[model samples]
Target: MDAALADCRACPRLVAWREQVAREKRAAYRDETYWGRPVTGLGPADARLLVVGLAPAAHGGNRTGRMFTGDRSGDVLFAAMYAVGLTNQPTATHRGDGLRLLDTRVTAPVHCAPPDNKPTPDERDRCRHWLVTELGLLAPTVRAIVVLGGWGWQALLPALTSAGWQVPRPRPKFGHGVRYEIAPDGPGRSSLHLFGCYHVSQQNTFTGRLTPAMLEDVFAQAKSAAER
Candidate 1:
């Protein structure tokens, strides 16, 4: 699945944009070869918890080849995860940084870095299959999912339905610390706990919209829920 995802070129616009960024190169990353392709989810298949973000940062995951690596957002996120015992370390600089997620996996709805950090509805739809497939595979063990930002929250709901969870009418709204328990639609499926957190973006963190303590609190709740 990872290999197939890394080689996906289903979205033409995303294909061009990712390659162009890799070719031009960010000045600071000029010496480093960018992964350029779609970034895959990181963690064990049997992870009990999941973290979903909007997409990779242009120069962060696209350059380092790992989600949440080489970015300020990741710094804040990993620190919070570590505080809640979700990770082995509080720093994620690169793929080989020896950082490990404990009973947790991180992924995104859109695999590639989108322009201006926003993906078109069409692009998101095209990429929905990957997320649905991932969710189906993780259904057995994943009990909780923390969605970072409204975009991810919105994108994830439909995929959850597709993966066998029943979303309630008048769909749940996204907000910091909002949580919902979604019942499974099938015999073999299990209920899922969905959580909302402010994205660990500079816009949120730089302005103190999302504090470390706030993020940690959310993760701590999620950790407890996952373990239960």
Candidate 2:
């Protein structure tokens, strides 16, 4: 799936943008080769906890080829995860940075990095199948999911439903620290605990809207929920 995801060029706009950024190259990363493809989810398949974000950052995951790596958002996120014992390291600079998630996997709704960090509705819809497939694969052991920001939260709920969980009428709204228990609609399926957290974006962190403590609290709750 990872290989197939990497080779995907289903969205022409995303394909053009990602490759353009990769070719132009951020001045700081000029010497390095960018992955320039859809970044795949990280961590083991049997992970109990899942972290969902909007998409890859242009110079962050797009350059480093891993979700939440080589960016300020990743710095804030990985630090909080490490503090809560969800990862082995607090820093994720590159793919070979020796960082390891502890029974936790991090992924995104859109695999490719979009212009201005925002993917169009059409692009998001085109990429939805990948997330649905990933969720289906993780269904057995993934008991909890922490969706960062409302974009991810909105994108994830429908995917969750397609993956076998039943979403309630009117849908659940996204907010910091919101939690919802979604029952599996199929036989032999496990119930899932959904959590919401502010995205660890520089916009949020820079303004103190999402502090280390606040993020840590969310992860701690998610870790506990996953254990149950």
Candidate 3:
């Protein structure tokens, strides 16, 4: 599934921007090769918890080829996950750095890195297909989801509804530590518990908008919901 996602070039703007960043290269990582393509979600197949992020950082996942890797945002996220016993390690420096997630899958609304860390509405809508497919495949085992940031929270709802989950007519708003339970419309499907968390971006972390304990608390809630 991920292999095909990595090959997508559906958005011309994203395609060009990612490649341009790769070529221009950051001064500190001039010798490193950038993946410069769509990034695939990562985690175990039987994951009970799914984490949704906004998009890849220009020099983070775009360079390392793994979601949330090689950046301060990743450092904060993985460390919190580790503290909550969802990861084997507390840091995500690179793809092959021996990091592992337990019963958790991490994905994003957009795959490619966007300029100024923001993807236009059209781009987000175009990228929704990938997430829809991914959510459908994980529907069986995924009992809970942790959406990081407003973008991912908003992006996931329509996809989940398309994937067969029954969402409310008036969608719930996004807020840190907010949770909404969606019961399955059809038989043979488990109920989904959605938890919201502030993005682990540098802007939030450095400003202390999202602290380690706060993130861990959300993960703990997600874990508990997954187990139930």
- Residue-by-residue lDDT tens digits, candidate 2, 1-228: 888999999999999999999999999999999989999999999899999999999999999999999999999999999999999988999988899999999999999999999999899888999999998889889999999999999899889888889999889999999999999987656998899999999999999999999999999999999999
What is candidate 3's lDDT per residue for 1-228, written digit by digit as tens? 888898999999999999999999899999999989999998998899999999999999999999999999999999999998999999898878899999999999899999999999999999999998898888889999999999899999998887888989899899999999997776556899999999999899999999999999999999999989
All candidates: CA RMSD (Å): 0.7, 0.7, 0.9
Clash pairs detected, candidate 1: none
lDDT of 1 by residue, 12-100 (tens): 99989999999999898899999999999998888999999999989999888899999999999999999989999999999889999
lDDT of 3 at 135: 84
Each model's lDDT comes to 0.94, 0.94, 0.93
* Candidate 2 local Cα displacement, residue 48, angstroms: 0.5
Would you list the clashing residue pairs of candidate 3? none
lDDT of 1 at 213: 93
Which stretches of model 3 miss by more than 4 angstroms?
none
Query: Candidate 3, 191: how far from true, in Å?
Result: 0.7
**Number of clashes recorded per candidate:** 0, 0, 0
